[model samples]
Target: MKKRITASLASVLALSTLVACSQAPAGGGEVKSGGEKKEAPAEKVKLSVWHNFSGDDLRAKAVRAQIEKFQKDHPDIELDAQAIPPDGYRQRVKTVAAANEMPDVFFAHAGTGIKEYFDGGLLQPITPLVNKHPEWKNNFMEGALEALSFNNEVYAVPINASVTSLFFYNKSLFEKHGVAVPKTWDELMAAIKTFKEKGVTPISLGNKAAWLAQSSILSSLADRVTGTDWFLKAAKQDGAKFTDPEFVQALTYFKGLADAGAFQQGFNSLDNTQMEQYFIQGKAAMMIDGAWALTNMAATGTKEQLDQVEVTVLPSVPGGKGDPNSLSGGAGGGLAISKKLSGKKLEAAYELIYTVSGPEGMKAVAESNSVVNYKVDVDPTKVTSLFLKAYNLTKQVKFTPVYDAYLSSQGAEAINNGLQELLLGGKPEDIAKKLQDAQAKSLGK
Candidate 1:
């Protein structure tokens, strides 16, 4: 993060950070324009890949199937793909990287998230490969590659649009209970009270990973109170701090929801999947999650259940400084090849990445309710009105910064932990102070 984040810098910070460290990624030569090929390597070449797509959700299923297809299509290449749990994926990858055991290819965020790899030479740039495929390069949504590039070199292929926050509500439930969908802070509170009185969870929240609260809720919620410019300044420690009145106010609003019984019992212990299931099964009236949930809902919910789900942003807060129409979002990362790869191994690694990030792979996930940077036509028959609604919603909104996407590792930990603590009755002012201190130290101030 810099002393200031402009619109361009915000676009750059939009991608996330994932895998880092050392070692393998595979074959990349001429992929048949037909999307079909046979590995011609005289000796079998092995490539290890790591990812966090272990779920029954359509998004995960799409990615898993594509990788399997890649392995099947190239019989002479041994593709070792590891499915790490989402919550622990980054740590496991980093732990390996710290031991200098980076995989041949692994998922990574763009921008400052992967800056260490780009600067340390841990990963190779895919700019040449992208340039080689002009059609493929142009297929990407504008500003997508820029998010993952540094010094005129692009690293990861951004796969998802990665809009971090949205409110998914059971429209029928709201109607049945005579409660309107919240459009203002007071209305939101009223809805929460109404749902609580009716014994239905107002919001199904899953914060076990700590990131859920920050990314899916507070990212946009903070924007509602502090605004994008203030957040950018605060993140960079320019003229603001997390301890400032605006940020503390954001935290207070966040805590207000929790204190008012907005979420389910044991929400902090449950995972996001569980939270989604709670809402899907009608135990909860609403859920606050990212656009990624569209696929999950499409895959897991019955048609009737799916129809009842409606999407919206968090309500406008009083005297908020941010744009009410914006959500915290941007292009997300893709497979990154290791620096160790060269010759046939390098080509193989490129092929391994292209298998998932190229046109075909991008389209498959898009069909599964994911928003991809790659332009691919999705089958309308496979998606629900909710899916289409969410997809179109992304196109219409402005994006605000996602803190972890731009935050230093130390600062990220402090805020994430602080969010959990605040809900458990910790003071917002104290967490704000802790965040300010950790971020200052991280910035070497």
Candidate 2:
């Protein structure tokens, strides 16, 4: 769910102007005119929330519905929810942060991405709040809260967990082409060749938005090549380097796919939505995307179309150190509070976070076919078969962190831009060096 913003620099600079104006604090109870001094009614607390649920998809609907319920239950709190597009969300957050105008509560990812805000003193530590509510802490799945923590302090509330490196294929197309489900790199390549021979795009990928390939394809490829251990070491600049053969091999393999015409024509120009449409229209045989996409697929496609789709992990790479079943995703996204919030504003923020990340919100997310981090009582029969398959697969696999989530913004941008370059005839070794250079600069090595 991470994306780089294409927002204008002027708008970002303008955010600084908004920061000078501060929100007025809520007024306390007033004394009555009577000699018997009766306390006056409490004033409504207004909170501004920023989130990336902008579309009319099921995920958006679920979020909107939860906001409505929260407003209904807490009439004293006035919530001003703004739905920013995913592409511009990170930039918007940065702009607000630069202005010192962060909303009361804002949507954020749960790893190194949030660490930036934590380091910058923009986010409020919520560990004490979680500790106070044992019920809330108990509801989260193991490691859910921890993923959102830094240096033993939790900063955000995880809403949903996800597996990003899933390959969703058109089952009917596979059957039509007499291609068996691939279990290894060779088999996958052979299928790609076969599909190409039959005038079908083997995989539908759109990189114009820039993050799709990195999050979905390259993340899984890195796992299959050097595994999670190497990635972590390399990211930390402990000893490993991106120019190492294993890492370069992963890039080379990714480049090979692009050269072999595995993806659609003009893939670099198509956005994520267009790529999904290509798969749904049967123009492509397979699509590599996050598990959250199931909700949208189920909401937009017919039952037959849903039945025609099947999910699987990336195929195993030969002589690799990684487990073939290792997946690339974790706690997908969460909510963080502004450090400026306190008293009633802070209380309302906590309630909103819990409402969205706790049982009530988790249930809605699960029912929509997306996996959630909280332990909600979801009816198995009510879940989509596609989601059930993903859920079951997730249980059987080792989860690896998404590259973008694990790397700093600078390092992530390097990998993302490098991948795009690699696909467009750039050398894998060169791309690796570029990434290495970016990592070094980011780490001040």
Highest-TM-score candidate: 2
Q: How much RMSD separates candidate 2 from the native structure?
A: 15.4
Error of 1 at 197 (Å): 4.7
For model 2, the stretches where C-alpha displacement exceeds 4 angstroms are 1-38, 133-136, 380-383
- How does residue 71 of candidate 2 score in lDDT? 87
Q: Mind giving the per-residue lDDT tens digits that candidate 1 earns over 164-267? A: 78888999999999999899999999999999999888999989989889988889999989988898888889988899999999999999999998988888
Q: 240-298, model 2: which lDDT tens digit per residue?
A: 99999999999989999998999988999998877877887788999999876787677
TM-score (all chains, Cα) for each model = 0.81, 0.85
Task: Please report, as a residue range, the 10-residue window in candidate 1 with the lowest summed lDDT.
Answer: 16-25
Relative to the true structure, candidate 2 reaches a TM of: 0.85
